[model samples]
Target: MDAITTPQNRFVREKDVEALPPPVATGGPVAWMRENLFSGPINTIATLLALYVVVTVVPPLYTYFIGNAVWTGTDGNACRDEVVGYRVGACWAFVWDKINFFVYGSYPADLRWRPNLFFLVFGVGIVWLLWLDAPKRGLAAIYFFLFVPVASYALLYGFPAIGLRTVGTGLWGGILVTIVVSAVGIVISLPLGVALALGRRSKLPIVRLVCVIFIEFIRGVPLITILFMANTMLPLFMSEGVTVDRLVRPLVGVALFASAYMAEVIRGGLQAIPKGQYEGAQSLGLSYPKMMYFIVLPQALRIVIPGIVNTFIGLFKDTTLVSIVGIFDLIRTVESARVDPVWSAPSVNYSGYAFAAIFYFLCCWGMSWYSMSVERRLAASEKR
Candidate 1:
């Protein structure tokens, strides 16, 4: 007990070892470039090629879009390179002149305030629902899903009793039509798709069979075919004197088309869920609906957020297809305005198309970004 038996008693350091600094050559930009860009001959060459392309392309694009762009002009004459005796790029004046048409289509200029208010309400609802920390989310959902629709309809179509004049769907065009179509498709698709997915997975034969048929049938055809059928064939099938709103037919078609695709995405997620999860929910004495709602679906949906967001992005871009059925969406308005004799110029076409591209890009990017944010938040929660 008096003699130490530990290894520490057997040996002792006579002096401390000198500490050396890490190699400077291995810690800076040079090291990073060697590791990432020039790690191998193939990578080095690829990096050089990429740099060349960007150097050659980006500045010219910048010059065209911004450097040589015509910012303020009244008509085609103002943007004409021949008249100006210089090279011109984008004719932004045309876009500015048609901005109202782009936003509201043929919506009466006097009643445009209604659409502005509609946009404000829609924006508020979107912000409220998307802000995860915001108060009263349940009410926000109600406002977005129920009140927004009713109010949007009344505001756009007008209520005579309230002194608003009636405006036909035929007058609707541009971003207004695009938003309506995209919103309807997105709002209707998710729940409908969930039901279809659940039905396809049901033990009951008839429910599963019907869901399969619907999903397969819709997925088999191009979206254009669905729009045509909805626009033309749907009316023939309707009973005499039963008039369907022109805008609504395409809305139904887009919603159904998106729902079919969304069902497949959700079904993929549902299949990814472990069998043990379902069994565990059942073991807890939960009913089928409660098990799915509280246990199965939440996990499945979280696992497939990317797939859901991808479907949403596709649907958002696909709204442009409605223009074929005489619904003047954003692109359609651009096309119409570009050919106008008033604003007609060499650059007008390019500018109009660029504007359309930018609009679509921003909208799609916003959705993609939001989905990624939600995914990151969910991942953090899982870690905790």
Candidate 2:
């Protein structure tokens, strides 16, 4: 050690020692478990219990879903335990046979290609809009918000002027109905919700009161009630000869219901914004609309991205409620298909429901994963 002696400070040392490496067990799985799982008696006990439950539960689920699954069959007999000489798990053969019906419902087989094309366009629009680093995102927004909807309507409902056959909404069902309803709700809810949120916070008493009443009334009612009223009561208020399509009624109900909840979510984000933000925008001589568009709304929306995506996920799953109004959504189609006498077997019902569950889980999980990705991206941008 080289010592640097000062007249006022006699205890100073000049040399710096090299830093030592951490203990081998201090940076891996063992350290992680020690720090997180076994940090305390209660935590250690909980971890052990969770591990035991996983051990007990996962293997049986694995066996039922995979080991004993019937992969190929023409009908129910192919999945029957008696015919197979053992118990069975999933009946994927049934899913394979009914895949077309699950996708298209009673949509004419020739016209099925129309929905296929629509799905292709929808997929492209979604990818373009959702990919953060994509080029020309402003153009992507226009394509998604303006072009895709029009194109989808034309493709699905058809335009006879273009020699495409008119397909009634009554013929649409299954996954097609589910997607249409969810997409409409998701697309419509955000803008309408933002409007309502702003209105609720407006200085005008009339605007705030109207928004308050609307949001509360819609929020107070269950979605099923909204669908019922839309289905049975909404027509009574219309012009005597002006009939609303069955699908259109539920579409309106779902959109309105989702909008109310979305408004509340947005309002929460707005409330979280500091008052200084508003004042700063005003200091910049921005008009109310410009203030919101450029300064306030973006920050509020960014703060509430998770809530927005959660609402979307819930709305997507709630498309099943459309079935209560006699719509043939995915769950309705699955319920209808599973009762077929031709495919009757003990495993058929289980398989059909499991298939529905898997589809829903996958869709919801995708939304959740995308939401997390967006949140991470936004967070990174904020840190920068």
Candidate 3:
């Protein structure tokens, strides 16, 4: 009877539709948690312990930084004399009062807007690079690389003919000095480093010798020594009694030191390149300079992006050392700010330092993020 009924219904018999596959063994959050945080009984226990530690640690940090903080008022008394739960909380009031010191140092109060304008222009240049997607990118690059610096310097240093008052480098402190030194170091080091790397690999013996010695000498010595020597002895080389600008001396030292490190980094990348690449360029009748410039250097630079960025970060942080030579980079400026009797408080010092740390971290992280993104994009282009 069943067989007869089935045959009768054969033209249009309905059956359950196939169930969807079980999500193809997804690597979703639940699966990941299971694998990494709860892979075994021991791992689960360890994760719980870590969470406990985090809980224990985070509250105090929050209390120190935010929960007990005083953000208003003009002086240290706002933090100290106020009737509140936390006398020991962060005194961000001091930071706010001395914010200009941390930004422009002793830059003229009225002329502060000039540096502000320079910063705005610099920001625009960076936005052009990272976001604008402008059609005349080559011109934009030229403007950014060449004209921007001139304009910024003129703005900050003041163009007399334009009625801008001249602000000496001595007055340039805080983040302004730090940014200038680091930027100059990074910009000068890269091309100089590339040149040294090429010279080190040159067939000319004297050229190779000079490059090798320069790199080794610079790399072997400490940056502090180089900075000191630049500050003290650079004038000895200059004719008669021509004194170098205090800022210029540090810039020179930082550039030379960073370039030496950069040279080694680039040399390593040059060595990593496949011999076939060089041979292919030669086969195509490219000159030595043409081959290296058109093919070899680009690949080498890409390969050494991490090292280049690392050197840049180091140079940026090292600019703080300029304070030792009587230049007031951000750290020095913050230190000086904390010493002011009006704002003097334990929390004030910490707050100032914390602000500097956040600023530096933002700059370094932005640089790293941009470089990695560029690297991935370039790799994809090559693949296509």
Candidate 4:
């Protein structure tokens, strides 16, 4: 007797789809500036202060580089006049005059090609390694472990295989010294750092204690003190009249200093690994060394690649400190150039420092960029 009619369903179609709110035009460049620069009292103050700084500093820098008058002359009096009375900017001519000695150092006028070739080979090898994603890793290991070092040593040491003449270490200076010290320090520190890190975490108390002591003692002291000790005490440690090569002393000091820092960096990576990794290796019946090499260390080392590169960059910069100990590194070469009778003005000294600064900046910046790229690659691989 009572039949109820059912309501028809409402079927939504494409035209019924709601549109997204109009793209927020509030957060683009102008909106960002409004939020960050003019949002509140504190933000306004900071923005104004930054603008004031730009107004005060940027123009003078621009004029110094582009508009300031520069006098270029070899005569000391003329150079002096360029800076005697008023505010003067950098004298780039000083750099132009002494650029040769800065690059080649006191290496004999005829034999600059040896160091230049060393740079070329090292640079090419590094670029090759960085650019090749699918390179034969085993071949790279062989090149890094066996071929590059031996070849570089022979070539730089003038072993007559490459038709290069023997150049004494004393002849090494400027960027050559910086490169040699950093390269040798990097080569030595990697293995030494791994050993030290392992020893610090060893089951043997004695070994752990020794490594701890070595790392702490080195880290506790300033690198300048270490360089001084290396320069003075090393000669005494050797037999009298043995005459340790001055270059060798600084190289040893740099390597030792770098290794200490590297050990701490590696230890951090090791600590970040879970204990399960170690226990898993043991459960698989792997020996201590085999377990570490096969499972633990590769992951740990990858974790620490950025840190390793940072330590390398630090050591590279610290090579400049050898100048204080009378080793003629790049900085010292620049200092020596400033003292040249032809370019002894204050402006010239400033220009020389600028040149050295640019050189250091280029190297350190490149290393930092490489470290960043490696970090990103590792992070992406982990995600996959």
Candidate 5:
């Protein structure tokens, strides 16, 4: 034993490793429910309450809108008990009959194709702006900013070049009026507001003072008063025998009112830019206007896009107020439709309002989606 030399192995490894079993509960619906809805006593109670609310509220809505909705009827009477087996069925027929009014208002029936065509082109342009990228977007923006309004005017009023009959402004109402007012307000307000914001931020005392006064004055006054003043008071100041169109007044008022609020929003963005950004631009030998146009404004606008869109959405909904000044916009058109004695079923009225809400929701939501997409794209570019 003493003479024996031993060689010993020093390394050892496990040959019988145990495989992992699945988790007690993976991240499936069950785990999500547990985490989100029933992780604690408070959460469990909230989830139960919410489920109860849904169970109680949803079925009646479904029954009313879908189960008993009258899809095919010529009049309210047709939507009543004799027709849909119950008078309570929603009178979708009334909405159907007045759909044209909702779209074109009192635009002459024969010449509606013009507005319809204009709508088609405008819609396509909007879709292009939303779905496609700029620089390669074939300038859909140019179409909207330059060609659309002029073309809309010509087509809507009657293009002598095209042999279309002129439709008087007096006859314009319904969604046509709503769209025009909102579009004009949005288009004019943005640039005007940007200018005002810049002026308010200008180093020149006189310019900044003027901007502050105008912005404050506009912001202080009620929009309806502005509309009234634009409609009545402005004419008194005009040269004798000069005429201002009634339709033009509300449009001006809405644009001016919107611009004040928009200026504040843009100003907030401008103020958010760090002082270093301004100094950096100045160090590069950029002039004041050049610094703004090439450097500052873009970043400021990017920062305040949500505010800008919020302002636009407000202006869009505010277009309904034009009804006070006698412009029959979308809501006004619906109001006019409701007065028809033949379609005055209670169900019809509720349906009409719901329809209007749906239209506004679709518009605002689409705009929001577009804004978010643009934000994501810009963020990606900046990261790159």
Candidate 6:
């Protein structure tokens, strides 16, 4: 009793207790590896396999790229030696030499700046459109609809007073052709797609049947065959002496192909919208167009943005197939560069291909990121 009273007489200081050890550092690298890579036998095996791959593949790649490996400007002796076990890494020098040809194709040397300027303007316009929220979308629409196409056409195929000589589409090459083809296809297909989607869902049987047949017929064939038909058979559809530009042929093919797929994607969106939305609009005496424009489409489009973007990406990549018809897209441009006598090396081919791959990866990745951002923004807006 006496000892208990004495203990009660003293007060403990604030610093008497030590602070708890910091979280046991459970989220650090060591803990992360333990949890993710070495958590169990299966994880351990996976980690080891990944480690094996990194070790086996990465060092050689690093050395091949960064080391003192010669890839181009080899003599006949060296070329023969390479074929007989003197292996070399990628020859980027070839790309350096032939980059202009790849980028501009046969664009007149003096007029190359015209395409470059258009490319810059278009890129800026796209970035501007994408970056701003609640932008003057109507103005942006006008710029897209009225200004950009006319400006691009004028810049690439110059009119007088621009101080730039005219360059025809025939001379377009590299990623430029790919970008143009894809952009035009996207712009044209969207409205056509919406129309086709509406038509397919129309109460009118004739309209629906026609839409169905067009969609199914286009979707049934491979894109390559469609492109071949465009390249070969499209001319016959025109009047005598009415020759279409080669660039126009691929554009037509891409538009038709993309519209079919986009129609299906839009139809999926339309289907996902509740029937009550339609009934509600009808009850309000809203016409079909008004209902779609105001109520049904907005919701449906929000839901299907991902599908639409995925289709866009697919169409973008498919534009490369135009190369088969002799249009010099990015791939074809690189191939053309590879055949250059000055840059003729096996390593150069790989380098050019790698460059094209990087370009494509950047574009596709940007588009995917934009799509995801839009999806998130729409979702948050809905929640609000």
Candidate with the greatest lDDT versus the true structure: 2
Query: Ranking by lDDT, best first?
Result: 2, 1, 3, 5, 6, 4
Predictions in order: lDDT: 0.93, 0.93, 0.88, 0.81, 0.86, 0.83
What TM value does model 3 have? Answer: 0.88
Which run of 10 residues does model 2 get worst, by summed lDDT?
A: 1-10
Residue 211 in candidate 4 has what lDDT?
A: 98
lDDT per residue (tens digit) for residues 1-384 in model 1: 435767666677799989998766987899999999999999999999999999999998888889988899888998999987889998888899999999899999999999999899889988998999999999999999999999998999999988988999999999999998998899999999999999999999999999999999999999999999999888888899998899999999999999999999999999999999999999999999999999999998888899999999999999999999889899999988898998878999999999898999999999999999999999999899
Model 2, residue pairs in steric clash: none
Q: Which segments of candidate 4 are over 4 A away from where they belong?
A: 1-21, 25-56, 69-88, 132-134, 160-163, 239-241
Q: Name the candidate, 1 or 2, with the larger lDDT value.
A: 2
**Which parts of model 6 are misplaced by more than 4 Å?**
1-56, 65-87, 132-134, 160-164
What's each prediction's clash count? 0, 0, 0, 0, 0, 0
Task: Name the lDDT value of residue 273 in candidate 3.
Answer: 97
Residue 21 deviation, candidate 4, in Å?
6.6
Q: What TM-score number comes out for model 1?
A: 0.92
lDDT of 4: 0.81
Give a tens-digit lDDT track for model 2, residues 162-234: 9898999888988999999999999999999999999999999999999999999999999999999999998
Candidate 1 C-alpha error for residue 278, in Å:
0.5
List where candidate 1 sits over 4 angstroms from the true fold: 1-19, 22-47
The residue-by-residue lDDT of candidate 4 on 198-298, one tens digit each, is 99999999999999999999999999999889988999988777998888887888898899999999999999999999999999999999998999999
TM-score of each: 0.92, 0.92, 0.88, 0.84, 0.88, 0.83
